[model samples]
Target: MKKILSVTGALLLSASSYAADLTIYTYDSFVSEWGPGPKLEKAFEAQCQCDMVFIAVDDGVSILNRLRIEKTKTKADVILGIDDALIEVARGEELVQPHGVTVTGLKQELNWSDADFIPFDYGYFSFIYDSQKITTPPTSLKALIESDAPVIYQDPRTSTPGQGLMLWVKRVYGDQSDTAWEQLAKHTVTVTKGWWEAYSMFLKGDADYVLSYNTSPAYHVVTENKTQYKAAEFSEGHVAQIEVAAITQASKNTPLAKAFLTFLISPEAQTIIATNNWMLPVVDGLTLPAVFAELITPKRIGFTPKEVAEQRQFWVREWRSAATR
Candidate 1:
């Protein structure tokens, strides 16, 4: 009994000694059971002997707002789920600090000028159409503009996917983008704030198509076990969206934060993202989800973050005139 008690005491001391902890602030879904949340926490703790304390908050904007309110006094060691639209806002607020370790291996995937943030996953924006309602899907962006079927899209000023669709027009039609928007405006039945509202409306037969990611259909086919919706193969390709993660300036623990970022890009985490999150992994060796590995593969498109950041304001201004005019 004395020996057993001594061993137990030693084990408790060992566990207590290694309780390194770090905090991460990210979008709520990121930590959800259905998302990458639980898997990442377990992986980081096991491999690095660190406790990952996830500060689950509202969407990206809410995370940013909280960061803004707290500033340098904030609790999170890292922040994830900022997109091209929100990247500028993050940059403007000076919310992030660089990781001492290089965020390498993203070179072939994304083209960004700085190293302050790193992209983990990316996808193209396309129209998700219900096959039951529309037998022949629109083949190109132009076809959607001319289609008789009513369409509903998320609002560009507010939604990330909506901004992606707006950028899609700018890249595809260039100077003719306004004219394209003018045409698309005619066919729009509703303009929603986010994918949930718009996609929910689409599912209920409110609209024929919803503006969303190319991999959006993967969830329906793989997890939901149905093919009620499919992404259109556009002639001009689709608008690309790259989601990034970075350590926060307000962090109390930088080393553990960097480790978490490394783990996120690790093969284990990437595999989870591909299968569970329905997103393309940044690392090379991670296997894609079977449905995505089979029915859907990522489509290539040409655009850069510098270009995205540069023309974003102009695109929104023009889209407003064309769409709401």
Candidate 2:
């Protein structure tokens, strides 16, 4: 097992350029042509006059999984995509260390005071559909799960949105989640390993609805002037995913890592992330696009980070058994 993990870890470090002052590990979408990574990297480079690099992985979960495999020899100075649900899991594994950025100017609604993780952006996990095709949408999570509408979602074993759905069903259905998963699987077109795979399939008009963020439509409106995409606000509320960054326990560049984390919550970086990443900024006051106001703001409901960490494996096994039944 150690040899396998070592090989996997070595594969990640394959053929990189010069030694970067700071190496950030993040998701693939964040560094895409349309994502915030390029702009943020350029801006930070100009500010610090240092070579900063980003190593892109499949998704948020993939970042942590890589860290777990790499263990002590990780090349990542900071990991920037673990969501709120997995904070405890990361902390318990001792993969991350405290990010010493002051949380004074953040949005008060977040109520964040963790010494470890600093939130960069957040959004609600929602099922989105083309308004032109579906006139009437599901009013609640229950309705969506029970309806025969064909759906596409990520696998809970890999994607954060998929993990959110597991929590959502558990929160709403509780003891009946096994039944709910079986029913959902009935109409589920496919479960992919990552968010983009499922979202891309939905964009091809293969499914009626796709799991995504509530702010997803804002990107369509801003980038393409297309308003057909819309998120269905569930009556039962939503599971909020606050994407965060933390300095790795193995980092020797803690100062640079801390500076990068501090910059993440700043107005300049937050603006780029909000528009490009399609998520809400963690900072309080930033003049954003008018379309952002129109996005659905569902009531937040889910387990604490500690609770999620404790029972994640159990729920995952249940989901696996039930989803495949």
Candidate 3:
């Protein structure tokens, strides 16, 4: 039973690696200079006496797409960056294998239990607003969608946040979601291709709200020392996107891959991920910056991977038909 300290000396895992080369598939930004890739790669190499190669793809979904194309012929030993929403699709496609790690030291709120995928970092999808401009943010997801306040969000076709908003709407609105999308389109400033474009528009005061993460404010607070940006805390629980990793079926170095997975949840790596990725750690009790403590610790809500995988296309089509009308 590995409990997050407020106790002592918990979360212990043996680091074991083989001499074989291991290739990991992940998103582009994840392997960027500022991202956690270099640090994580160095740390793992120190413990695991093996060559760990990181293969880059466009985004989380792209990794799955590459797997779909390559299957057993793929060169990847481990795959990372596919979030909880896509895990079921990946599993259904048989792109990943079970890591067989005994899960412990996870935040209880996550309520996580999966044999194939290992959660690394997570963030709640949220609507961001500048406190300097809007004093009263919408109190809940329902209010935000219903109100005429100008809002900007991403397109579900290209952006993770866009897909997250789709899930949030479905989770909260259910059968009435079609009507909600129609309502949202009324005051929507514009839907951009990605999170950055929508956020850039919001920063220019083009809109009152932009779809983003609860951790968005922390970056402003910590880096710029400007705290006007804030994530709205909706009475309806927010949808979360948890980035996860799994062993590929083509992996020749299973032991090394599993070791790398275990290392990801370790305190050392969690600390790196939280700060660098601008997301919360999957495990508990890692020391993060003061701004992290200030971020909203909202109640988690939304569908499972299986639910999202099954209904994603349906919801995307739903958004496409109704969002601009």
The prediction achieving the highest TM-score against the true structure is 2
lDDT of 3 at 4: 29
Q: How high a TM-score does candidate 3 get?
A: 0.86
For model 1 the local lDDT of residue 273 reads 73
Across residues 39-73, which tens digit of lDDT does each residue of candidate 1 receive? 77776566666677888664554566678789999
Candidate 1 Cα errors over 4 Å, as ranges: 1-21, 48-70, 84-89, 103-114, 295-299
| TM accuracy, model 1 | 0.81
TM-score comparison, 2 vs 3, better candidate: 2
Name the candidate, 1 or 2, with the larger TM-score value: 2
The digit string of per-residue lDDT tens for model 3 on 153-266 reads: 987766677888899999999998999999999999998876666777888889999998999898788768998999999998999999899999889888778878877887
lDDT of candidate 3? 0.84
Most accurate candidate by lDDT: 2
Q: RMSD of each candidate?
A: 7.0, 8.0, 3.6
In terms of TM-score, which candidate is stronger, 1 or 3?
A: 3
- Could you tell me every candidate's TM-score relative to the true structure? 0.81, 0.93, 0.86
